[model samples]
Target: MFVRNILSAIIISVAPVSSVLAAGGDTPPIPSQDWSFSGPFGTYDKAALQRGYKIYREVCASCHSMKRVRFRNLEALGYNEDQIKAIAAEYSVEDGPNEDGDMFERAALPSDAFISPFPNDNAAKAANGGAFPPDLSLMTKARANGSNYVHALMTGYKDKLPHGVELSDGQYWNTYFTGNKIAMAPPLMDESISYEDGTIETLDQYAKDISHFLTWAADPYMEERKRTGFKVILFLLIFAGVMYGVKRRIWSNIH
Candidate 1:
């Protein structure tokens, strides 16, 4: 009887502990698709992309990697070849095997791919404490309504701890990261990277361009594809309308 009573007490104690543990762990609510930042179907904003590139270069590039994208590819975004080459030359890429049979790194060429920040997967994980910052290449498709999600995640970290919760130093909670928590320390700070061209401080514009860039990254052909589709759809509707009128004219004779 004493043992049964002890077990019941233990269960009671553990239950509340578990409940308390669960309560504070809840993530901040994510905005719905109806929200302003939810859609990816938008035109690329040049000024915002320029600002985002500045952010990427000054802030996020230190730890994260975008090895898939070549500096030259930025030319598609309207950068000149000389500008692209100059940018590519800024980074030293991993390379090796000289006549002496030793591995040596060389400056990245315009034609070469961007270098991964970490040497390899193990190194990346070890450095980041087992959380590798995700590549931005396909991040648009990787997350739901990815553009706004990126923006929200950037601006979402809070100074005030939510009830029953604690945030670790240098760790942040993002409303959009899967599981609502992330190892990446909040990367953006207002005026953290200044724009010479005086853009608004609001997150909406920043989020919009980054998402647009990622959308283009996911499918470079998207604009052409969408344009072609619209043309085809319009043509088909016109054809259908013409056929319906012809049918109506034939039916009038019968009537």
Candidate 2:
């Protein structure tokens, strides 16, 4: 009877703590999805990467800058040099001092980093109602479960808020965002952009493509690294086998 009372007391003590933890946690769990680049020996889907780049260019680029990625980096998505040059020519970049010490604007070069929509952080915040749009260059690595979070955030907008939750002005509800309130509004819609490769243009599709692209941006050499690792492992296995054979031959007479 004493042991039963003690166990009941422990359960009573733990119940409120568990309830508090469950209720107080704000960030919703993100569901994992299969990706072409997910596992060992996995590689990126080229077509998805291309479509992702197109989506980023049309949608996310307006707010988020990929400062680490150069126009030339598009070659990794299967764009030829001429196509990259043409794409770079579409934007104007600031360049400097042609005998006159003044900065001048010229067409963006293949080597130029992606142009930012806002000139500076303060300007970006001012334009975005005091919310700074983060650069997406390393965003996939910046967040835990990064790809899943990106995909969830892109598709998590809801028309109605949950009960007892009040959002301040300029804040939007996102089911997957931390605290369930995000500053950015829904950025995608059904058939928002046409795909030349005949892929469906749903919001989920857009989210997946952009997530894949961001993953590649975070680790462009992931495939190369995996390939090199595999080769090293194979070489080590073969060398180990040869060493074992030589050891057996050397000790055969002694035993």
- How well does candidate 2 score on lDDT at residue 97? 77
Worst 10 residues of 2 by lDDT: 19-28
Candidate 2's C-alpha lDDT?
0.90
lDDT of 1 by residue, 1-255 (tens): 999999999999899868855766544455533322223444455565666677677767777777677777786677888888888888886677888988888878888966677878788888887888777877777877566566667767776665655666556766555555678877776555666887775555555555566656665566566678779999999999999999999899784
Q: Compared with the true structure, what per-residue lDDT tens digits does model 2 show for residues 61-149? A: 88888999999999999999999999999999888977879999999999999899989999889988999899999998999999988
TM-score of every prediction relative to native: 0.76, 0.93
Can you tell me which runs of candidate 1 are displaced by over 4 Å? 1-22, 32-41, 96-104, 168-170, 201-209, 245-255
Model 2: CA > 4 A from native: 1-25
Evaluate all candidate structures by whole-model CA lDDT and list the values in order: 0.69, 0.90
Residue pairs with colliding backbones in model 2 are none
- Tell me how candidate 1 scores on lDDT: 0.69
